[model samples]
Target: MTYVAVALLLGLVILVHELGHFLAAKAVGLPVVRFSLGLGPVLWSRTWGGTRCCLSAVPFGGYVLLALAGEKDYLAAPLWRRIAFSLAGPVANLLFALCCYAAVYAVSPGEHSLAGYCVKPLAWTLGTAQAMLAAIPRLFGHAQELSSLVGIVAEGGRFVGASASRLLMLGGYISVSLAVFNLLPLPPLDGGKIVCDILVRCRAGLARYYVPVSACGWLALIALMLYATIQDVCRYLA
Candidate 1:
């Protein structure tokens, strides 16, 4: 049951991230092709307004596809608008973390001094995010202090068994971690998109290279996930 709760919590966190992109696109009048929850074969779908919203069979991750002609076509929008759209996803994750932390604090003020748990978490989260970003390069050189989805569920279930407050705190940490991960300047990630927009705004010749680089980045990300998953499986089996 605790693992089930963690799975549900993860779904909500993902929804929060995707909602940021969906709302931002609507606000800026960008054409959103599909807003999908999960990946693989479509489990269910419905068309609404200009977007086809659906749930896929696998619940690994969600994505928002744009109806633009190509990657660079997004540049047709104002730079600020593009940046906002790109940054919205990660920002939403950050906000979700804050809300989770705030909710937990509100429920049990006795667990922590008021000052220790409230706004300080927001500041601490930002600092933690920066530290995580600085550690990304270590993924190749050493075993990273990162968790795969399997690991998250395992740890989250243990926390849930301990106490509801612990589970909530874990959720908050996961939210912050997701936000920071999305901000990495790699392609197919929110941070990479943000950087691409910035380069375009700066009229840097390298702006054109963003898409190609991101393609490679996606492969690297997949490899990283696979490595992390193997580590998680080995630990679990042991």
Candidate 2:
């Protein structure tokens, strides 16, 4: 039950993140091709309102695919629109975390006042976000501290147990983490893509390198995931 809860919690967070991208793309008049709720082979899919919605075999994370062909290519969009689309996912995760924290506070209001009811959640969410932002500089120096999907699920399940409140708290933390991580200025990440877009806009000559840079970024991300997974395995074994 704990494992199932953890998986569902992770899936919900990923879905919220992707939903933000999907909505932002639509808002910017960009057509969406697919919105998937997992990473691998599709278990089920349905097309609705011109977008293919999918549920895949894996439950780790998901993605939103935008239709970037013909006149509606992502590159052809205005810089602000592109940036907004890129930022929407992280913003959605943050909002989701805020809501989770709010729910937590609503359930267990330490203070009985109306001010406490409203301010506590906001304060908690902001504090967590601030701490996460501050920790970004130390991430590279502490590779072993990084947790892979497996490690996250395992540890989160243990921490959450069967308590709904604990589950909410854990989900909120993961959501905040997702928001922060996506904002890192590395290629293929949302922040990295935004940076690249800005650079290309400033110097159109650099447009040629975007694909290769994105490929390299993906490679690096995969390598990091593998390293984290190995670290998790070693830690568990010890």
Candidate 3:
């Protein structure tokens, strides 16, 4: 039961991430090609409101595919709108994290729960995020220390086994991590897209190199993921 709860919790996080993109695209009048719950083979699919939503075979991550209205139509939209679309995912994650923290801090079955809510959770999340950023130097300085999907599930399972409150707290921390990770200034990421868009606007020459840069970034990320996964498996075995 705890394991199932953890799996559902992780899926919810991915759903929330994609929801941000979907909502932002709709708000900006951008057409969506598809919204998938996972990556790989489509297990189940349906079309709604002109968008094809699918459940894919892989259960790790998900994405929202936006349709180009036209070569000129999409380009005609203001740059700010495009940036907002890219930023919505991370912003949503941050907001969800704040909500999770607030929920965890409030005592349930009591009258003062909502009234006693404060910004402490938000501040704590910020501090935790900063500490994570600071620890990046150590990843290169020492052995691989980051958790992969398996490790994440394992940690979530442990938390769920401990208590629901702990699971909520873990969910909040994971939300913060997701927001921070997506904001990294590497191609294909939200931060990367925003940075590249700005660069292209400032200097048209950079536009031609966007694909190549994004491809390289994708390869780098995949390699990092592979390394992390291997480390995670080894740690689990040990």
The models' CA-based lDDT, in order, is 0.82, 0.88, 0.82
Ranking by lDDT: 2, 3, 1
131 in model 2: Cα distance from truth in Å? 1.4
**lDDT tens readout by residue for model 2, 1-238:** 8988898899899999999999998898878999999889999999999999999988777888887763226677899988999999999998999888878877874666677756877787788889999988888898777899889889999999888889999889999999989988899999999999999899988888888999999999999999999999888889
- The local lDDT score (0 to 100) that residue 31 gets in candidate 3 is 86
lDDT score at residue 205, model 3, on the 0-100 scale = 74
lDDT of 2 at 7: 81
What's the TM-score of every candidate structure?
0.88, 0.94, 0.91
Q: List candidate 2 segments past 4 Å from native.
A: 70-72
Off by over 4 Å in 3: 69-77, 108-115
Q: Write the residue-wise lDDT of candidate 1 on 70-181 in tens digits.
A: 8668777788777778888888988888777776776775656767666766875777677777777786577756679999998889877957777777777778888888
Q: What residue pairs clash in candidate 1, if any at all?
A: none
| Residue-wise C-alpha lDDT for candidate 3, range 1-238, written one tens digit per residue | 8877787888888788889999999998888989999999999999999999999999878999888764345445677888888899988988888888778777445555444466667786888699778876787767567778888898789767868778888788888788788888888898998898887778867767877888899998888889889999998899
The window of 10 residues in a row where model 3 has the poorest summed lDDT is 107-116
- Comparing 1 and 3 by TM-score, which wins? 3
A best-first ranking of the candidates according to their TM-score comes to: 2, 3, 1
Pairs in clash, predicted candidate 2: none
